[model samples]
Target chain A: MFYLLGLGILCIAFLFIIGLYNLDFKYLFMISAPAEKITAAVIIIGILNCIISILFFFGVGYLREAVKAFMEKKIFQLKTVLYFKRSGIYLSSCATLGFISRSLAIIYLRVDNNGSGFGLGYSSLLIFMLICGLCFILISHVLKESVALKEENDLTI
Target chain B: MSIYINLDKVLEDRDMKSHELAEKIGITRANLSILKTGKAKAVRFSTLEAICEVLDCQPGDILEYKAD
Candidate 1:
């Protein structure tokens, strides 16, 4: 069910944060830097990752509840619709913030701008999340229209 | 822009109460009230048929269009 899926996504995001903490992006930077600068970059990246993780939690939680409502045949409820919309925004923010954080870390280390992770060859998880978030938003729009139509149907004598 | 119900006028002419017509048509007085007040978004064909049969009136006699 979607509730389990949301939990899975949250776990994956947590693992992603841990992976980021242990990752050696400096090797990719391939440039010598002061210890303080390296430490600062790592700390900033960690903070951004934590923020992203928090947003992910909120997003996933809302998604879980929305899916629960949907399963209960309440998909057109305005609250559920708004929950989905908020979930989409939060999920998308996670991806965008991740891109910015990692890119900034790379830029800070390499003193260059070759750190963007949006290339086709890059890992697809962020892009996938972004697409998924957009899909949720689209679903919210469809549900909103369905709500109006359903009201009309119910009122029909 | 919306539908207008003329059921009150027909009921008046037929000297039949709304409750009686609703009972004869097998619908609730609340729903009949919705129809009478023109608050209904639509009138289903089945209910229209029942109402027409009960009131001995055509669908047009019970519903009107009031362009806004």
Candidate 2:
């Protein structure tokens, strides 16, 4: 995903360079200067979103494992685990918002450019972010439930 | 939910301290406390087996079921 984001950013930069040079294109889908600028901004936002999303993924994994270990009554190393889990939830939320904003920016640029068809770029990105958001929500719920179960078990034992 | 753990009775019968048992099992005293308090969600099969072997008792003698 990060690679895709980087590629998109590079594509936008190339477009901007071409636009600045006032290069004539025989290609059917040529973008103008203003449109290129907008695309570049969107791509930059997309890159940021990807970076956050990657971090969130690692965070979710760490949280899930910590929760599982906690449930198993492994309490020796809990403080750090709890910290990571909390931070992961916050990062995931931020990544979701970033992805949404980037997608909207891309859509706005497309419309401004008088691009006839809806491009696959923005729609795919929106879908990916939505899926990631849902996954993170599910992960949070699972971790919460696991923690509750561990507490209950501890109380009973 | 309330669960029953008979670890205290087994430890008493075996003449073992919580810290000593924890040291033998290679787990922390806090974890042993959690197990004794019945606050642990799950126990590993290996750990359970080790406890039973050390205490010369069955799992049924150490744990009992209770409804929430």
Q: Which prediction has the highest DockQ against the true structure?
A: 1
Please give the C-alpha DockQ score of model 2: 0.20
Model 2 TM-score? Answer: 0.39
Please, what are the lDDT tens digits per residue for candidate 2 over residues A66-141? 5556466664443534644464565456456645544555465442322223233433433443554456456556
Query: Model 2: C-alpha RMSD to truth?
Result: 10.7
Model 2 CAPRI rating: incorrect
Estimate the TM-score of every prediction. Answer: 0.73, 0.39
* Residue A61, model 2, lDDT: 55
Interface RMSD of 2: 4.7
Candidate 1, residue A18: the lDDT equals 46
Model 1 score (lDDT)? 0.76
Over 4 Å off in model 1, which ranges? A1-35, A38-47, A110-123
The clash tally of candidate 1 reads 0
